[model samples]
Target chain A: MVCIDCSSSSATARLLPMSHQHVALRRFLRGPLNLRPPCCSFPRTFKTLTVHSSASPSPVLAASITSEASAKVIDGKSVAKQIRDEITTEVSRMKDAIGVIPGLAVILVGDRKDSATYVRNKKKSCESVGINSYEVRLPEDSTEQELLKFISDFNDDPSVHGILVQLPLPSHMNEQNILNAVCIEKDVDGFHPLNIGRLAMRGREPTFVPCTPKGCIELLHRYGISIKGKRAVVIGRSNIVGMPAALLLQREDATVSIVHSRTKNPEEFTRQADIIISAVGQPNMVRGSWIKPGAVIIDVGINPVEDPKSPRGYRLVGDVCYEEASKIASAITPVPGGVGPMTIAMLLSNTFISAKRIHNFR
Target chain B: MVCIDCSSSSATARLLPMSHQHVALRRFLRGPLNLRPPCCSFPRTFKTLTVHSSASPSPVLAASITSEASAKVIDGKSVAKQIRDEITTEVSRMKDAIGVIPGLAVILVGDRKDSATYVRNKKKSCESVGINSYEVRLPEDSTEQELLKFISDFNDDPSVHGILVQLPLPSHMNEQNILNAVCIEKDVDGFHPLNIGRLAMRGREPTFVPCTPKGCIELLHRYGISIKGKRAVVIGRSNIVGMPAALLLQREDATVSIVHSRTKNPEEFTRQADIIISAVGQPNMVRGSWIKPGAVIIDVGINPVEDPKSPRGYRLVGDVCYEEASKIASAITPVPGGVGPMTIAMLLSNTFISAKRIHNFR
Candidate 1:
């Protein structure tokens, strides 16, 4: 199977043998049977025939016939970089003319390794995008009042356009209480109940969408995938990923279905989808057979599995079986380079949006 | 056509005319083909045909058939009344014990006839529940600052446990700006972006949900409907109704589908659902054919269509074709006595919830 490098526009099409093409096209047809002409005639018999093994196929035919066989990688890293660049330019313009810069204050309550890594990445993202980052690292034993006090101060600070609290606070400190203490205007993570409620409801747009799901939708839009009238299946029901992703898809006019642990015959439903977003965190759980041949796949799970050949002694694997899925899917997002980078990019974008809304900047 | 009042307890089975029974059952089977048994050994012909001529069917058969329908009607009015009674008792108890009572402040910007009626109903609901209702009816030409000042006062007032601004604020006033001014804790209407965002994301619950949709779901819960694994469709994408209703259904573990204006063949989708919540506000938009026989219908639209026979000169109609839907749907909520009463009940319930949460009365 050929792999298409999505970062380059020239990789729009590629050729494969006729035998390979026939099998792939047949598989694609079965998946989207509703789109096939009911009365179309096809050659009922092919005697192990290979069409023009030596002849070069035109890009248009290659795109039409073989597109479903090879995965068109969603280059989220490049897209994220492009987004950061756009935000950087906008931030610089705001600073140069108005003598103002967007500021984000992040408060970390404990020293969990994952939380620390996330906070560091967020700060780095802020720096790269020309936004000022304020970090407050409190010990695990810090009282809830201490965190609330910092939030109160940040709330009053006019320079702070956004405030985010790293997750997994000390068990003694109520997470909801700490979160609700942040002023709504500065709650850029959009975790506030009010913001989330608005995001979930129709006709209302949240001031900030949760970073990860927003990133997935952004990837779709950047790739020019039409969401309207499509059947989208989101695997998982977590608030941060699956639920929000489903809501966002529906908002964009897709008929969405969510499958969770309680779902019966998840694959049966998934195989009927035009787009599949799997964020269930089960490595390689979505196999080739689970996907519709031409379905666009968005793998949101970032899990580390043992791989002896890897330099780090472990390698990242997504919820989708990349090798098998690539053979059947029209497009697929790779685990490491897919949803990961786009998350921080969306965070920066949200910060920029919050700044613009606060300062009345277009 | 025969009607079964499943709410009754004594209705018994009766044999109907062969033609009518065959037609109705055949239509039901065709409407939801997936529910049909796949094997030929399954009953190809009915041994008996049962029908009733009265609006209220025999009670014993109604109970048996209703159980097969898999959900009980969520009697919204009764539940709302229970909640209001509880609130009334609590308010009187608080007044006697501490000489303090919870108050609700309502702001009405313009005389949109619908908004006025809603506000009036809310005020009456508040009185019925023994909560103080404060009203501020502003002129249509009032500026943003005027509304802002009122919100500021309400926000600072300790007695006001809840604040609701009637929706469809005059076109001139920035809706978001006025909404954002209400303090988050006092936002009982749950229109604040922060509250909505929280409701949408996982592991987070909103302080308050938008009243009408919340009411609709509450009705389902009270009626003992099993949302899990059920195919639920919300017809409308309005932020206030359609969107939130879908989210609530999803939260309850239902496989949800949203059908909006952009959806092609909406009836084809609706006819496959076990539950339909229509909130498009277009009178009689959902036809009887769109309903799966024995499915439950919750019509949230309160459209005022001209009616020469009514004293008010206009009668309320729902998004569903009631006369037609009543024949097909096993259970359905009527336009006037259904979702409307539930909305006010939810508002009162929300106010009580706010008071309890504020005072830590749990």
Candidate 2:
């Protein structure tokens, strides 16, 4: 068994003696106490490591892991596989019992490579989960009326449980108008002004939550992070990421502060946070010095930087400087393996929730 | 000019020499900058004094002075009056030119004295603003469907630009159901789930902001409080007050933290704030020590505590320990004279805004 000492200069640390009683309690809570794993079964006896900065020489406590010695790494790929499997089972059961399969309709306008990749992945996820997928690809020159007609058609279709329009639509298309056209019930992206409004206001819960932020919270819950009364700082104020993340953090009883472009000395605020969720899309924007030692870091940025060793000549980087932050932060999620996978998982969860609501399923 | 230095118990300190130009600028911003003087305008300068405290010797700065040589009091009553006048003129103009009188439909269930008072004030404000007021007082035993049916009626009424259901309906009625019944466009109270969602989310603005919080921001803007980059701490997280106030503070570019029931050591957060908006409704919950010397205080609570000095045998108290806070705080809104009047003015403003949106008026 190896315990990574966060206070040490080395990437790894020595292992510590495990407490049998605590392990038993963790197992019980991760099993019977939780209704669903959201991904996979709980592992036993993972290593708890602390990373230390060479300059400070003081050990910072990172997250406690289970199955330290022989536990397989819980990467996004494996976790995503587990989620897809669970969803597949649930979808099949619903279909056999009620003759209803969840359906998602995607509308893509203009061929932006990134948008196309996202749409393709969504379609693939739908198929893996036994959800029927419909794709509507429009030409770059499609008129606003053309997009509206498709949205109106999907709105009336009872079989279509979710509707998502690829973002960054042609500059000429009124994004608001196109988005508003989607029926509230089918707004799986939760970008509808009404849904966004509901999410922002107190004493209200939206039918659908924006996927990315929901995913971040799910990760925290799965990892058993205590959020209540903790100080959480969300950097960036984008409609999709920073705003919703702050609201979610607040809902979970965290004292949340949102730092945006106008926020002076954001690092000061970030340094005080026990949890930092950065979605600014700036490469290595959050340095190790900005993080509070032992803080949980969720980096949502997916920037590509030059990497000569790779065939593509580039590697994906997170908004946070991972190598430096990993030494200070208690738990840090890597770029491609972090929030990205959770986004699709949350989308599937939202779809399942929508279906349950529509069918009045338990 | 006389400045009361509330920071010190002795209330004695040297007055800094203020240039004539500085005094003139302060006067212009506080007086004529207000489109209409809510009431009387005081002298440009009265007294300049500083208070010193052992904890922190920094003095609170005072801006305008009333006729009594008192520090400038934020006249919410007068400011609200000015807003109502503007709304009235707009309503009259709309009526004369477009043949439409902005109408507010209010539904009151049961006979809660406080709700009745609020409803009455709203009706009076509507009349004063030249907007038609529609009232429906339902019996205490009104069912959810009955209340929803009334909401539907208002939703369909073209003449009604705003719909507000006095909150705290009989326990039997589903609050969410009745609130959701109001169409988003006509939900002037901004309590509808959709509107609330928009208010909570980023990059989205609610068509109508909740009345009280909106009034608070309006008061700040009218009083020329610079919100940008300020540290704001809001006590409480009620949907109507704390939550919306935090969002508004964020909208104004302030770094806001919401301290609620679950918050530990709330005073620790409050003391760091440049502005404190307390709406917890707990009488005198916030003490002088919780405030920063120069912090602006907006007390939204109007709790009636036991005070047997008058015939009523009760006196109004705010969430803040006002007497002590007024001494320590740079600026404060008195309970009776602060947020109360602004609530009705905001309601009037919302009704007018709704009318303008519906009519597509410039």
Candidate 3:
């Protein structure tokens, strides 16, 4: 799916001038770029990257934009690039020293475009980090046993250091049972309940944290945004992003409140947050009025809303309206480049870690 | 540990007049009682039971009492008794029809008197419910291997339906490794991270929910307290209670918030809560002013402070000062009889469920 600012392509390349774009492009295409702050230098054309100035508000979404102050753009692409570069170097070091390559296996049950895009992105990230990627795509009507058979095969494959079954599997299959089949050691997605349980418990650490939430947390860490003892509010309580995000925040010692679909006054809770990471896929749900000024926002929601003026029928936007939050928030990650790139980068890092742990490659 | 209102004896017998006490005493003295509400009719005397009615508020802490509205006491003992008695009948029926009696094996690692008392009470409850209880007491300095050996044996035993490893194992042992050793099917205490993870997820059922939080929720259910669409604030972020309680509340569709030690102005959050469950161990931490009027308070903390007037050197008081909170809350659990006995009762219930599942003893 059109990963907006959360995409590393934008995180790393959003601020790149025309001249730097070529340098970034050449380095990225060559693979294994240097471990630098501006890491991801993908060469994709940003036809949809609409630049908004702090002085001017777009007429189309003018009602949503209330704050005049420009928020410091949290360059997730650069940070993800840096993390990917680190993983690349580590993977290379492990390969050179131990004669082993980190491998990740992806099992796709159905042909959902968004799921395909995510898997493709993950594979690309693995390649950049010198990790081997294996993929098995099944038709929509695949039986539960067929999916389980693939997972069982991967579980036994010594070369496969990590396994990820793309989520939202076809309605016929039982999701929990399938995910539970991936041996915990190879669970790179960190969707396993045990991993989540470990994450939720104080003084306990998970083998691998779920990628998106981990990325959101990594952004906060890299940006030096204080989370410990801060009042944080997580919107949405989904297992993948919101719940884990809240658990991660709690582990960081933040007093966390989770506001979800049943919440009577979600905005009231959001306004009390020192940090807000919203994963509800509602376009522009969190407005300037809901945010506490100077609060940090990490929007995980990437909703494609209809935009008749755009070349594409729809334009990608995060749960928070960027125009409004940018002015209100002291710092906020833009939709495409913010948390998106980090998810794939984390996947690569997890694969590298699994390989290291398996081989005792320290 | 001075088990107060949460104690079965006090819960079912505290309000019983002299003549009913004898009838209750006879029924409790017998091995297993019938499926009934107000089930726990133990003969534990009131030497430690200090009654503090609203008519005679303790002069020492009188300043904290502001509201005069008396709260409806949520008798956990009676509720726990009812649950236990129901289990008692089921166990008898299972034994007669299937010749399979549910057996629980508890492993205690330390010589802590409080832990011993808790174990004894658990064993007593098992007998009262017609469930067989097995005990393995190890020295304080027991090795990890020794503990695992017992767990493995229990796991293999055909008779054992449930297994529990008492918490606060000596400092020398690793807690997580030991707890993880218990087979998930027999994890009656439900401290297993996998069990906790299932509790956290939506549309997923845990093999067993942890006892304390399960008891708290059971109390709410029995009291006819609606958690759905309600605002719930769980104090403390402890794995055993606060976190699971929040997860359970969320599953029940309540908007849940976790307030911890690091939280700034926790009272502000508690005041907004329609249901407040303060599990933090600090004595009298949640004051009258902290609670919203007509809120339901489930004080899970059982802290002992010095009491010169009592026969025991110290008396048990919950996190919320009952004198103040009783007036402010619509319903409040007493320290001893509130959530204590329910913990043991749940252990029996989980065992019964395990036996039923294992033997298909319908």
Candidate 4:
């Protein structure tokens, strides 16, 4: 778990005054509008703050002003395992007490290896948690109607409490239409537009939020990091991760700013964020220099960067340069172990919640 | 409209270098997070900007730091009339050619004077545009079932291309349940969650955007203001205005940030905005210092502030201070004549668009 460095020196005290009209004008222009305006300087370096994790790079020169300090490891795998154990216990309890097992149905329309692996992993996770898992393996050339029909069948199946249709279903199939067909009640993936709408509006609750963003926030909560009244920035405005993450942050009472492709200088927004969740899938895009001291970093990006030393000739890296970020960021999530495990964990949690709600398990 | 002060010495060129780590740190904290520090100062006083529009206030002390300057007025009344005239011509053309006339139906659930006046104004607007108008007034004590039934009736009426249920429905009724009952095809007010969801999603178009925000953006377009690549800040997070307004600005390729009640130092966000559309009903909540010089101002607020000299003993004011804003902003919209007229105009526009889309009218 990323350590919440509450005692660390923060840049909050050095906040420039807005009373100087000249300085205020300068700051406003230097914001997102002037992305590459030669140099928009700000003092960020404090004392030595370095983080060490498995495969975490050594601190770079970016934090030269500070002494070396290791950041607290945000062990997502352990936390996810803990959640899985909880679910396993609950699933066995419900099964033994009421003869009711939580069931999840998956519809796989294509033969893409990645999609197949994901479906297999989900089923295995369900099995490990003592939940029933059903799968429909459709051919790569399956029609959109065929996919929708399977979704409808799964939707009506009383035994199936959660349904997930593997994404990237043949390009010919209308993605939105197919994803929307799965009833919101069974939308374990939570890709439904209605659910997203609910998430955006205050006072409305979505049945489920998209798993990835939910996992990121869950990690923060499990670590006891407060989000309320904090300045959080979500990099990448992708519907699945960035947008939902921002909405979730806002729901938690954090002032959120979204930095997207259209943004002029995304670093300007990121530098001020107390918590940053980057999901742009661009390797090392969030440099250490873009970070504010004592800020928490949750990298959702998983880009395959070339690694000649590895057997696969490439290794996965996140949007943040772990080597540099480990020096500056108070706490940061590693590439593979950070958000990935949490995604599966949240899916399991949502499924368990759905099943419990349906049969009045309480 | 305030004069475009491009000639004013900008601080962009004076932007400090990012390579200086210490300076960057200070600037980052000073950006938005530390809104009110003890020594925080920024000189924002450019000149006294006094805008006089139909009883708008005189220059206030907030704008006293600079000399007086007047902003170009955004004549919402004229713009609205132009839109109405265009709609009227289109309605007549359709009637003479295809014998098809657009009709709007309203279901009023309470007897509030403000609601009645709005309904009457809408009816008159419809008459002026040659669109058929129908109304059904229900008692305040009416049950949700009764309101739903009336909505169903209007939904089935073929001639009613657009249907609006006046908001602030009786306390006893479920607002969402009644509003959802209106058929999506005739959802002229565009309050449906699905419509809002579509509006939020990129590449997905809403059947209609809520009137006020849509009108604000329309005003921007009509005035030839380019939204792309601009920094926009929307004040207030109401479903009808602030939220949708931000979404609309994003759709226009602007980097949009939303400042709501939870936001700390809302003025900091507003100060950098190249375009500001304020919907919060706080009279003079936005002062001259809060605005960027030469920024476009769309004041959606219409708060009735007390004024003894006025015949009504009070006058309407937008969220922005018109006098100060007129001096600093490149263009400013007056309260009563600004978004108020634009709302009705947009409602008419949406109804016309709905009629054309449904009937395949070019």
Which has the greatest DockQ?
2
Regions of candidate 1 where Cα sits further than 4 Å from its true position: A1-68, A84-165, A177-188, A201-205, A308-313, A351-362, B1-102, B107-120, B136-160, B305-315, B357-362
What TM-score against the true fold does each predicted structure earn?
0.72, 0.79, 0.81, 0.83
Local distance difference test, per candidate?
Answer: 0.68, 0.70, 0.75, 0.71
Instruction: DockQ each candidate and list the results.
Output: 0.28, 0.31, 0.30, 0.19
Candidate 4 lDDT tens digits, B1-362 = 32221221222112112122112221221111111111112243454445322111111213232555567889899999999999999999988887899999988876877678778989999999999999999898888888888789878877889999887676777777777788888998776777877777765788988887899998999999999868788876666677778888987878777776566656656666789988765556677767767789998866555555558665556667776678778898987798779888888888888889888888
Give the per-residue lDDT digits (tens) of candidate 1, residues A1-362: 22211221112212222233222222221111112111112222212322222111101111122323387999898999999999999999999878889999999887776677778888998999899999999999999989999999999988988898877577899988998898878887766666666666554677788788898999999999999978788887765677778878987878787776655546645665778987766556675556665779998876555545558655666767676567667788887899879878888888888888888887
Model 2, B1-362: lDDT tens digits are: 22211232212211112232122222221111112111122223435334333222122222222223122567799999899888878888888898999999999999877678778878887888789999999999988888888889889999999998886677898877788788889888776656666776554678899888898898889999999988889887766777888888987788788887666656656766788887765556676656666678898876555444447655556666665566567788887788878987888899899999999885
Weakest lDDT window of 10 consecutive positions for candidate 4 chain A: A29-38
Interface RMSD of 2: 5.9
- CAPRI verdict (incorrect, acceptable, medium, high) for model 2: acceptable
Per residue, candidate 3 scores C-alpha lDDT tens digits across A291-322 of: 76677999886656555546865665776767
lDDT of the structure predicted as candidate 4:
0.71
lDDT tens readout by residue for model 1, B1-362: 11211211111212122233232222221111112111112122223223322221111111112212233344556777776787788888877776777889999986766567767888888888789999999999999999999999999988898998876677898877888898888988776766766666555677888788898887777777778878788876665676778777876767777777666556645665778997765556675556666678998866555545558665666666565566567778876677767777777778778877787765
Tens-place lDDT per residue, model 4, A1-362, is 32211221222212111122122222221111111111122234455444332111111213333534455667788889999999999999998887888999988886766667778889999888888999999998888888888889988988999998777567798888888888999898776777877787765788898888999999999999999868788876656777778888988877777776666656656666779998765556676666766779998866564555568665666667665677667888987788878988888988988899888897
